[model samples]
Target: MAFEDVVVGEARPYADKVVIEEYDPSWPDRYRALADQLHAVLGDTLRLVAHKGSTSVPGLAAKPIIDLVAAVTDSAAEPSYVPALEAVGYRLRVREPDWYQHRMLRKRIVDGADENAHLHVYTEGCPEIAKNLAFRDWLRAHPEDRDRYAEVKRELAKREWRYVQDYAEAKTEIIEDIIAKARAAGVEVPA
Candidate 1:
């Protein structure tokens, strides 16, 4: 797929399907390359740019998409950053003011069929920001939880779903349980 093929709000016939893959050691390097792309467009506007989610964990099985978190000045003020990101390859497809004014963008043509990238945007100090980072860190440090999460995702990926988001939602129970354990162990999970 070309850069233009994944443009914002475009309908995807197979968007609901989920396919998990084994750990790829090169994910971090790819993440850094994408970060470079973001920095070129966002400049200093981005407060934090990080690779999060299952793909960020070294041994975790994931849907082969890089999940990135980019926290900026004010996500609700799309005028401040949306256009610039759109100018690059990212295509903004989700906006939710009610939930920390979060936004999600995608640059799907990363490495042919083997890889893709998804950017999750949030304003500074959004609770979800900490959760995302903390979850990744916890899983990275705890092989048990990481393996469990991978297993959960592997099972969920096979279920029927109306949308890809539903597959993500199905992993919430396991995710939250793991997060709660992390917090209890003093992992500093953000509120």
Candidate 2:
């Protein structure tokens, strides 16, 4: 199926089934360790090392993966940072110049292995980061909404998908809608 064809309502069957382990209280520690590793390599090139996505939200059921957002001041000028990140096990996966010039890298389990964690690098003050963080925070505050999302994800994991990215894009609509509610409630949408 095409990327846009994967919606939360329809793509539930194709997502990989991930057992919802008990919310790890140590997720913060994980983020800190990972963040330190990132900072050690990038140093001044790193603008922010934020714990983002479902893992960053307490009480949320995540796929045992830490999602990080690293903001750089200027992506075009920071070519060295990409190679630096690659040296530390992060492989560039997605580059979207049209979408806020966003760049994404994923940490592989081993050489030529599937990704275990995702690091999203963007120019400092990128609007996408705000929306992402806001969505996570909003879900943390709303258990019913969070539960609903978890249900969709769990169901989606049972289906068949050509690529994992397709499964992720499927959740975009619900995510965007929840983000809208978050913005309406004055949850601090970053400019």
Candidate 3:
């Protein structure tokens, strides 16, 4: 499927340049709170919820957005869970059925705070879920790679991006390299 076709509503373009901020100490607490809320909202429909991405790593510079991964019984079955999430102020932003039935929802101004978060939802047993968790765990365990990724992010942040997705896409090479290293070390990223 085409990229434009996957968006649920109007695509939000990033303003000029990407912003990478110093690690915030409050991220984990915020994640836990949100996770709790999701569990309450989703109940048995939610298989698992986890903190992923750069923000999950301690001391790593990130875009100041909390990235979360959620596994549901079937992400493509939006009717099963999307409405519940929307009631809690999460807006369905992207729905990529081709990509492991991935669905991304964004919540801005979480808990009356300016912080924003993205919840990447996928079906239970999806390989991407394991890959994301493994990547996050690898980064947390290896500071040298974490610092390297931070440096790359800072450099990328200096460039202008038409969309935040473009900036994220730019980091694919380094991300894949690190993931490769993690796999070679038996990080156990499921295929």
Among these predictions, the greatest lDDT belongs to 3
CA lDDT of every candidate: 0.82, 0.75, 0.90
Model 2 residue 4 CA deviation in Å: 13
Q: Write the per-residue lDDT of candidate 1 for residues 106-160, one digit (tens) a residue.
A: 7766423233778899998888988999999999999999999999998988887
lDDT tens digits by residue: candidate 2, 1-191:
44334222233233354445546888878888889988899998898989998788888777777899988987655476888987778777666666777777778675663446788888898888877787777888899888877777777666666667766777787777777777788787764
Q: Which residue window of length 10 is worst by lDDT in model 1?
A: 1-10
Q: After TM-score superposition, what is the CA distance of residue 44 in candidate 1 from its true location, in Å?
A: 1.6
TM-score of 2: 0.83
For residues 1-191, could you state the per-residue lDDT of candidate 3 as single tens digits?
Answer: 54568888776677657889999999999899889989999999999999999889999999978899999999999999999998887889898877899999988883553348899999999999999999899999999999999999999999987778888889999999999999899788776
lDDT of 1: 0.82
User: Which has the greatest TM-score?
Assistant: 3
Clashing residue pairs for model 1:
none
> Model 1, stretches more than 4 Å misplaced?
1-16, 110-115
Q: Candidate 3 has which clashing residue pairs, if any?
A: none
Candidate 2 lDDT trough over 10 residues, lowest sum:
6-15
The count of backbone overlaps in candidate 1 is 0
**TM-score to native of every candidate shown:** 0.89, 0.83, 0.94
Show the lowest summed lDDT stretch of 10 residues, model 3: 106-115
